[model samples]
Structures are given as C-alpha cells and as structure tokens.
Target: GGISRAGRDALGEATAKILASANTYENQTIFLTGSKAYTLKEITSFISKILGRDIPLRFVSLEEYINQYLNCLDEYWVRLWARTYLALKREELARVYPTLENLLGRKPKSLEQTIKEIFTDKQTGEKESKLTNKYWQASTFDNK
Candidate 1:
C-alpha cells in the first residue's frame, strides 16, 4: 500500500497547536500527513534497520488476505476490508501534505524517530494527557 503514516506525537502536537490558534485558523479544514509517502517495503526496511532484524514481507492476493484473517475476523469484516485492500493496492490512500510540518514549526517525525520513540527508551518532551488517567491505557487491535 502507498498510504502515509504520521507519528502520533506529531499529530497530537499539530492538533494542539491548531486548537490553541483557533482564531488564526478558524473555519479552515486541513489534511495532515507525514513528509513523505512510503511503500510497505520501504516502511519495513526502516523497521528492519532500526530493530536490527529482518521484517519479512509477504505479498498476497486479496483473497489470501481475507482467508488468512477471516477466522479471527467475521465474514462481513473480511469481505468489507476487501475494498480497503483494493484501495491500498490502487495507491488510493497515499498523500503527503505540508500542513503538519507547518503547524509543528518543524518537520514531522520521521519513520525512524517514531519507531524509536515507540521501541526505544520512551522518553519524550510530550505533555501528559489532560484527560483522565484511563486515557493513558493504549489498546491493541485484539483488545479494541
């Protein structure tokens, strides 16, 4: 898939900055994104280099994808996501916009930076959530 990936920290910062600047950016819609678009292979290559281990890539047909996940997911889910897979295959979800960088006053986090933030020492200057502590609990796909 040719879709974009943005770091959560950058997205959060951008959102905060935009909200604080509501008067300056009022009534304007924006599309935020990472600086560049990457293919799955390029993304995995970043992961491989960072983790110092090979992240395997398996190219499969849409049918194969549906069949593989159909057991864990429902028939409706598997069937519905066939459209998403097709869109990804068609490069329909990929776009990079400068709004995020502009708002953050610097480049959005690189893939490596985001990965390191997640996998390395989790130290960052990001603020603690103003929301309830329960918001800190992250959910995975299975959990969600």
Candidate 2:
C-alpha cells in the first residue's frame, strides 16, 4: 500500500520526538508498535538524522506485542477488553489518589521503575489485596 503524504509527515514528527527523548535519557529503550503498517527504516533514518548517532532500535508489530507480552490471552478482542478494564481501574485509582504522595509509600523517581517493581511483585505471586470501591474517595488524611 502507498503511504499518504500526511501519514509520512506524522511519522517523521513522531520519529524526531522519539529520537530527541531517547537521546535525553541515558541507556533508554524505546518501543514502537502500531499494527503492521509502520516502517522501521523510515523511522531510523529520521532518528539518526536527529540524534546524529547510529543507534539500533527495536520494532515490533502489534500482533507480536500481544503474542509475546500478553501470553495467557489468545483472542485479540479479549486482550483489548482486559486492557480497557485495567486502564479504567488505573484511572479510578488516579482519581482517588490524585498524586503519588497519596499512594501507600514514597513515589519512585521514575514511573518505569515503579511499573517494573509492580510487575516483578506480580510475577513472584506476592499477595496483594485488591482495592475496595469505597476507598476510591479522596481523603484529607493519609490512611495507609
């Protein structure tokens, strides 16, 4: 399929942003996925031009992302549904907490680090009781 001019422009801009952000961070890994349409070479060319360095970037299709990251779920519909559900729950938590200070402990410097810790704890089968709906209210006192 032929790429639209507008699409190319958008991709170029996204590539530039990615490269700039990646260069700013030390030892950064960027993941890009959008079905099976995007081109790695085009993105790399733009990134290389912006960063002034030849850095290897990883590219994976949406199918590959779901297959590898979301193992237990086979159907795409199911995976998307579960993703939506989790997103809503996270939003609900954010609404109540409003800030990282409202969380059970001190906030990590990096959100990525916090997510990694959460995933590790889950993988190790650490016991964590799910938050109750009643606790969704914003409280004046830190009730941990």
C-alpha lDDT score of every prediction, in listed order: 0.68, 0.35
Structural similarity to truth (TM-score) of each candidate = 0.70, 0.21
The superposed Cα distance between candidate 1 and the true structure at residue 135, in angstroms, equals 30
Each candidate structure's count of clashing pairs: 0, 0
lDDT of 1 by residue, 26-127 (tens): 887888888887776776676566556666776666666668777898989777866765666666667778899898889987876776566454454333
Model 1 poorest 10 in a row by lDDT: 135-144
CA shift of 32, model 2, Å: 24
As for candidate 1, its clashing pairs are none
Stretches of candidate 2 off by over 4 Å are: 5-39, 57-63, 68-144
**Best-fitting candidate, scored by TM-score:** 1
Q: What is candidate 2's TM-score against the reference?
A: 0.21
